[model samples]
Target chain A: MKSASFHLNLLKDTERLSSSPVRLRVMLPVVALFACIGMGLWWAILFTQLLMVRAEAQDIDEDVKAKSKAHAEAISRQDRVREMRQQLEQLTYYRNGVRAIGKPLAKLAEIMPLKVQLTDLSFAPPPLDPPPKPGQKISPFAPMTNVETQRFVIAGRTTKETPVVALMESLDSAEFERLITREKRVKSFRQDATAEKGGRRLLAFEVEYTMPERRFAK
Target chain B: MDADYTTVARHFQVNAPWKSISGTEVPSAHGQTVVRPRSNGRPPTGKLPPRLTGLHSLAWKLLIDLMVKIQLTRSKTIEIGFGGKGKSASNSKVDMTGVELFSGESRGAPAVRLVHKKDGWHILAAGFVPPPNGDLPQRWEDTPHQPVWELPRNFQSPSAAIAVNSGMSSFSQASAEAILREMSQGLGDSRPKPHTAISPRLSLKPQAKAEEPQKPAPIGRKSTLPPPGTPVSENGRRFSMRPLAEEGFHLAASLPEFQALWLGRLLPEGRRPTAASIQLAESALMASPLLHPAFAETKGNMLAIFVRRDAIYFAGYRKGEPVLWRRCPGVKGYDAMRNAIGKALGVEEELINDVLEDALVDPRPALEPFLHPVLHQLDLARAYLAGKHSMDTGKALLMGLPYGASHWCHMAEESVKMKLVPGHPFDGITLAKGVDASLAHLHLVALGAAIAAAEVET
Candidate 1:
């Protein structure tokens, strides 16, 4: 006998209320509505965030465009400053290269034993650099290898080799060290056709001496 | 246990065959002819009938559909009414908890829980608890109190099938004789009745009885009673019935519409052990014998007498379908038998059990007075089933007597020529460990309510 045969349930189904406060019959639609609202809010927020990100990206792109020219100008000015500094450094090297030969030459006169009758006193420095070609861009900075070698020649009429040796020995003194070196060779020694005031038949001699190097540097 | 719900529903449909799509008359949900709108869209003729008030008729149809909805709640601990195919007598299925609420005497309701598992039915728990007070809502719009009764830890279930015994409850057929009796008893104090006559509610409310006799019943043939399975109100009484397994007959029940409304809302949910179904106490008692092993031995054909505290009832079953249910007229309950025994044997009322069981005191003097009427009524019922349905009432089963069942059986054999066998309420069910079987007699109606409510075929 199925119980349902005896089941004459007077209580209707609607009377089957919820045990918990949440009634599924009424709450299901309510929860669905709330879920729909929440999704809508989330979509709105996501769309707003996307718009904000797009706007920020555009602003950053425009800002970068606006600042690019100033950056380039600053870079050019910096390049000009660097060039001016390099030119000033080159000038300093030129100043440093200026040989203090005036004092040394003055001392050379004092050191020379009247050169036994001085004839020719000349410094044969290495030949000056070749000038720049026409239309060539010239750099103000000196070349890295700017040291020059010169030869100092002392040619005079002397009575004998002894006075010449004395003159060479006097040139070797410390006061003329920067101006002259020991590297020397006698070019000639011959009897002079012209005599001195006393008619002493003075021998003519020429001596060439290597001079110290002069360098262009920082 | 499987329910005969499909047969019952089909029977109801056949009895009220007004299911027509094109007509204005359609069958009501509860086996009655009612006027309703066309099925859908509009009639094929394209012209609206004058009687078809567009939205009103459509709304009525919607309302009827909504009210007739049947859904099986799965969340309930015992999936009540989860139908399956099988002989309901052998298919003692469902995990149900049955409780008789509002006991009407000290509110002492007995609770029984049955579960089908491991190839058999088990009595998970059977015990008595003090029933909580079930108060109806103060206003029609108010909701009843949830968690009205907090069952003990042992007796509790996720949901419960509730059986109630109310003074205002009545069960009668819609036959002419019964209607004539109803009309004759209108607005008057009548002889005692197992259902309405002796009810405390009726005796207390003479004014209600006076106020409700507005329409005199029809003399004959055109009975105003609602058709089977439909509820109808007349003379301040609400009546509903279901088609009987016996063809062309339906079993009817009545209650004060107020009491029906009250019982309907007695167990509002929102708490543990909410109600899964509700049934009349006598209705439950009538069905309690379905699961007994003896029922199967009898091939689902049997007759049984149910003895309650205040009333005695008879129920007959044919192949597990209830065919006969009646309250024995003029015969009172066991308490009256006790009163007769106390008066005839000059014994104290408390010692009535002793006198009846001892057999030392020949209390047949008092016993005969009580059993004579009951036995006569039983004989009439047995003869009726045999003559009408060709069902042999073969040695009717006696149940819920509490005591003196043997004496009653002996008397029945001698006087009525019918053998009476004592029935155990839990005979077909396996008792779980620690379950109290001693009080099984008290849980008859509760157990029946659970079984019947759970047996609806899905």
Candidate 2:
């Protein structure tokens, strides 16, 4: 009875295998192959997309750097231009000032009497204080010297007997301050009289005076 | 019922087809028989028709043609009332007979007819109602008539021709006066006659002739100057004379002074004067009474005069040489110096003190009081740069940073030195870094102030 049952089961199994032979032959390999190919294609697409993204990022970085450099250069050039314009303006101002002083000086010369003449006419920047001695470091907190006061000096000469005192008074009247005199010397000379009678003594003097520093005080 | 049936049949015969039981016979009703209407029917060949061909009709036709050219169309239809009280009634009686006409025979028949009633004509105008499709009207050679009153020519006047030819209105009295004045001025012959009241009936021909002789008077005396003492005859005329000190003296002075007078005054305020202004002033002053050849030579060194708010400022080099002098303490702690160098070369104590202060301090504050003089010095520096001047770059930078004058002098010097090589000066000036920064700051401040003022005033 056992042998018979076993043989019967074997027969049943055989029948089952024979019933779906075509499905077994065709369906299994096709499904497996399709899944493999699909996975491979998906990986290729993802890799290509990643590479494109990286390239675009690099291009953007380069563009940003280039723009920053250009901006910096433009700023520098503008700074340079502004400096030049200022320098030009200052020069123009100075030129005009010199011309102004010259005009009045020329007028004075034209109107001056023959008895008076300027032996020396000089203009200098106001006198400056002596620079700090070498080998000594200056303290940062110390006040710097103001160079505003010592910028100009004027000196000249005139005829010996031209009433120097009266001339000084006139200058004072014209709003100039007088400086302390360093020297005043008189020299005597003998002059021939027009008639046969006599010789007369003539007096000549040399006077020197310093100019006070106030007229152009700021 | 039989009578009603006959009446219905008669009404049907008048509006629809009339036929016998065989569909071939014509129905006759009210003692009338149906007859076919003639294609080329004449209006009983009687008396002559109303004449509609004349100049007036032609004008109407022309008006219609112009309307068609401009694509104008009657947007609304005009209606006339008829058959009312006092209206005449028609005498003719008509009877209806039903008959069907051949469709082919009516293809080219007149679409409308004019029926003359006892009162007036009634027109049965007919045409095909266009399809509802929204197509635009097509261009065609022939168009409908327009009313005579709509013509543009009716509004034009005979004087329009004169306006078109002269490029001005003939009827404008102002234009006539302007023309007469121009003619008088151009001819330099006739004194301008006092204006007289124009007669309404004055002839245009005679007036035109009168205008011709007055053309030379204005032309002969082109000199804008009237005789110096001639009292101005006209109420509006006022002669202005610039002061001898300002105009005449400047004219007799040096080119530098002349240039200063012209360019300094004429320049637009708040901005620095340009090189072009200087050049222009130079040329103008050359022709002025104040012009001196010696001034031309010293122009490079002459001080610049600047007018600010209310006062004129002068900036220049001070010729400071010591001579016989006296020192007196002026009102405050300020010491006054009185020096007699020459007859007119007296040095003021205040000026000496200023020089001393400038020497002791940085030149910046000392230079402040003489703004115009500083500007003049700047001009000289520029001139020097154009010639030959040494540049100390580091010193220039230091001076320019604190004081404007030093910077200007430095740049001028730099420009001249850099010019040793062709185009080098331009490149050097452009590349300089220190002075440009300060100049930009000043300019920005000025511009901001100007903008603020403008906004406030507006």
Candidate 3:
């Protein structure tokens, strides 16, 4: 019989892995120790930096806070100034509208014939006949639009139809064309017989024209 | 349904020793020791075997299942501690007689016991009650204080105490037999007894039988009465006789058989059958007389250098125990060595060294080149063993057939500077039989392994 022999693979297994568990046991503690040391060092650095940052922050705290307060006050003053400017602009827009009405009124006065007698002058939309319902849908081709387009209405009495025709020609002049379209200058014109004024037969009339719009400065 | 059993609970009222009493501090006496119980109160048990610990629970279960299927006894034991948390000796609720209860100082109130027997675990309640005096344990003081004992200057930690205790215990029980027993236990009982006697074999050769009859006993006793025809003494006690040359014949005769057995046994199980043959050629070297000096000089701290076709195996033996083994790769086999020689000799065909008496041709140049690389590796191997394992290369016996080739043995001897011996192929027994030297050298390692195995077996 042969003497007892050992398998090479078996021998390798016995010797090679014999110290593996021991190595792992030792390595774990070593790794943990290094990690703990690294963490401790990192914490120390962070804490020191925090202390230094806190000191510097304390020194600059009052300066920064005062500067911030002043900045806030300046911002508030700037907002108030902006509000005043906006109010002045709105007032200017209104004043410009009043001034614009004076020129148109002067022009209207120049255009009026002596035979014409004005009873009422107003800035309003022409009254709609049989006002549309709230939910009514206008035809796509309809001249009425969703936009609220204002118009000027004038109600007066004229002595003759000739003065009315002359007044319409004067209003359609180049100077008035800049303010209003001549084609739609008089939205509606009506003539009616009224009681005689100053021993002459009078023609009562109503006229509606495009309303003036005020354009503000950019 | 109304049950007769009713639970009764009572809380013990403890009396205070003092009402906020204060005492003056006093110096403690020197050399005074205090005995404190461990926090867990659980003694340390030895480590669990790696076979159990290395495997996962599922793997263990599978192994157990397989064993059960095969009807094999379970070789594993899993420890289960049954008790209340941190409760040791007092947890078990065994039957207590009246006398045992009265006499026992450690008797506590009755508690449930979970007993593990041959069948399974069983729940039990001890039939004992607490003493009627209402004497309960006092609360432990949690004040921080100095330790009870001072450590020796050398003692590093409390865990080292185990090693110290073991050292002390071993020191006290030290003896040759104890040392041997411990060595045997630690090394496993597989080591061979080198000096053990072999079973004598009956002489079978015709010349040996004639020579045995002719040779007289070295010592003789005179007898007055007519001598018995047989070589039996007058007291009728026969004497065992054998030629001195044949004393270790059985050992030499059994080497080959044992070598074959060891080769088979040492082969790794579950490996592919055709991977490689593990040649054990150390039998002749082991059985040679040259080994006796080395064994004596180092007390069996011998390193066997086994050269094979595939690799060079380095094994360290300390007192017949295989302490370490390392295999160095890239060793050139005999075929390669022979091819190199044939090429150097300008021979077109294979040259077989067949003559028994002719002078052996010198293939030194061809062999040296091949051997130089091997020697370099050997040197590195020695350095590794010395640096890592603390093995003294100078003290270890270096024996291998590779060293015997040409001037390689002398070269190794000079380098290692240890008790180096070129292993001869045969001992006295084989030599007396006049076995061919060529056949002996061819199977040298196998013969050495047999002898080594025989030594271990003996």
Candidate 4:
């Protein structure tokens, strides 16, 4: 049995030595190749999935951007439409206001006396005097600028001596003003042939009124 | 008549007598003066010819009738070329009872006495006689001898006869001399005075009275007339003083009406209608009479309303019939007319309003009629830039064409090979994407062609 056992062991050792190089060279390389192929397949699948996900995200991002742009454009268009509507409305309102005040003003103009002619007329919000300067701030003791009284100054030429009084009376009685705060008259010689021949004088007058604001509304 | 003639002859003899009066210048048997001729019969045959019967005919009477008709009533009368040696003397005897003078005496009745002289018979008043011893003796016949009745009274005045008469006419030189004598005798002591009253008054006054009060002698400086005031209204509102070139609407219950309210309100007092108003009326007439036919029918009504509105508007500006258009506020004739039109057409007012509003706001009409076509071309260019339509046909077709054409077969094959080089690498991407890419490339080429075509068309 010992001799048989010794022969078997020798055979086993030879087989092991020859197969070990073959296994190292052939089996290792084949297994490594199969393993590499499997890993490559797995990575490719992952890469494909990653690519799909990225494409989806890009699509979502583009969709959001497009929607946001469209919304902004719609809002802009709405804003333009609103602005146009407001302009048209304002124009209509102005036209109506002009129409409303047209007749009364024309009648007033017609009844105005021949000697008086209005050189200028302006209509807008009443002017507001500038606020006190920073350095010139009002103190408790400082007198006010008389802001309580709103003045309407009427300046005109007159060939008559009493034109200022007549104008004041007309304005007072005609209900054109609530009050006549002040009346000023200055006499000046008019170089007219008739006036100079008669040696008559004319008065250039500036009359100021502090009228009630309610009269204007009507 | 005989007595008058004798008296006239006696006066002639007294005035002028021949020194050969011893032939027997003596008183008649009844103490009337008488003169005896030196020659007792007709002159010798050579010295005087036989009278022709032609002179005795009524032809000379006809001439006398013509002369009396033409010259008796004239302002001045004259006669010329009288002779007594021929048949003319006999004719003169028949036509004119006047004094006659001959070269020799003729035996005849004392009523028709002939004096020895050189030439003709001349008619004279009974009171007039010639000088017997001077050249010829005068024979006087009975005829009215009033000096004032001799010629037309105008001839008796101190006026000149412009021309002398010749023998061819009845108004002759001898007749002219007699007329001048009568006129000179008639003009006694009368003088004419014209412009008697005012002329003396004006002349007696100062010469400078005609130009007195020379406008105060133009004082130191030239005076200026008063200036007409502001062309526009003094109020803040501007007065139109006329209608606009295009009529504008005053909205009345959402309807456009021919309301002259704005017009009346805007015009200043005593403002005159301007040329703009006339042009506005004309333009309104020339345009479509009715705003649009789709809105209304009965164009006459529309025109009437339009004309009335214009008339009132213009009248307000003119200040003529000023109160005609001053109705209650918000009253609109145009709206009424529009409603009437809608009612006539069996349509609702709202529908008409829609139509009118559309007409008012339609940019199509505003652009087509008012805007030039070049503006439309610019719009098309902008649209083209916005990728609404392609600009080329051949390139587009070539890009779209599959590899089937005969001439481009090689190029098509090369394209296919390039596409297939990756062996279906382009699987997931759509074929349309490739087509779009190709089209984009073709579009570049098409842009050039389109520009060329557009240039040609322009």
Listed per prediction, chain B TM-scores read 0.68, 0.15, 0.32, 0.12
Model 4, B109-171: lDDT tens per residue? 011111112233221111111212222111112111211112221111111100100111111
Q: Per-residue alpha-carbon lDDT of model 2 for B1-458, expressed as tens digits?
A: 22432443344356444233212222222222222111111112112235756886676545543432211111111111121111121221100000101111122211111122333322222111111121111111111221111102211110000000001101111112232233223212212222111111111233644644343334222222211111111111111110011111100001112212221222122111101111111111111111112212333122222211112222111011000000111111111111221112333544543443343534333333333233333434334332322222111111101223332343334533311110110111121122233222111112111111111110
Regions more than 4 Å wrong, model 3: A1-37, A56-68, A88-110, A119-151, A178-198, A215-217, B1-458
Cα displacement (angstroms), candidate 2, residue A192, comes to 20
State the lDDT at A71 in candidate 1.
88
Give, for candidate 1 chain B, the lowest lDDT window spanning 10 residues. B38-47
The predicted structure with the larger lDDT, 1 or 4, is: 1
Docking class of 3: incorrect
Point out where model 1 deviates above 4 Å: A18-22, A25-37, A40-44, A47-51, A68-218, B1-93, B105-107, B134-147, B176-239, B456-458
Off by over 4 Å in 2: A1-60, A92-99, A110-117, A128-162, A173-218, B1-458
- 3 or 4, greater by lDDT: 3
Q: Fraction of reference contacts reproduced per prediction?
A: 0.39, 0.00, 0.03, 0.00
- Model 3 agreement with the true structure over B1-458: per-residue lDDT tens digits: 00100000000012212212221122111111111111111123222336565456556545533442211111111212222211222322211111011112244321112222233222222222342232111111211221122122121111100000000011111111222222223212212322111111121233533543243222223211111010111121111110111111111111112222222222122211110122112222232222334554655455656554333555554443333344443565544555665677654433523211124755556566666665665665566556534567664344434323434565565654443455543332212122334433333333332232222211
Candidate number of the best lDDT: 1
* Top candidate by DockQ: 1
TM per model?
0.58, 0.17, 0.31, 0.17
Sorted on lDDT, best first, the list reads: 1, 3, 4, 2
Q: Candidate 4, which CAPRI tier?
A: incorrect
lDDT of 1: 0.66
Interface RMSD of each: 5.4, 59.1, 19.0, 71.4
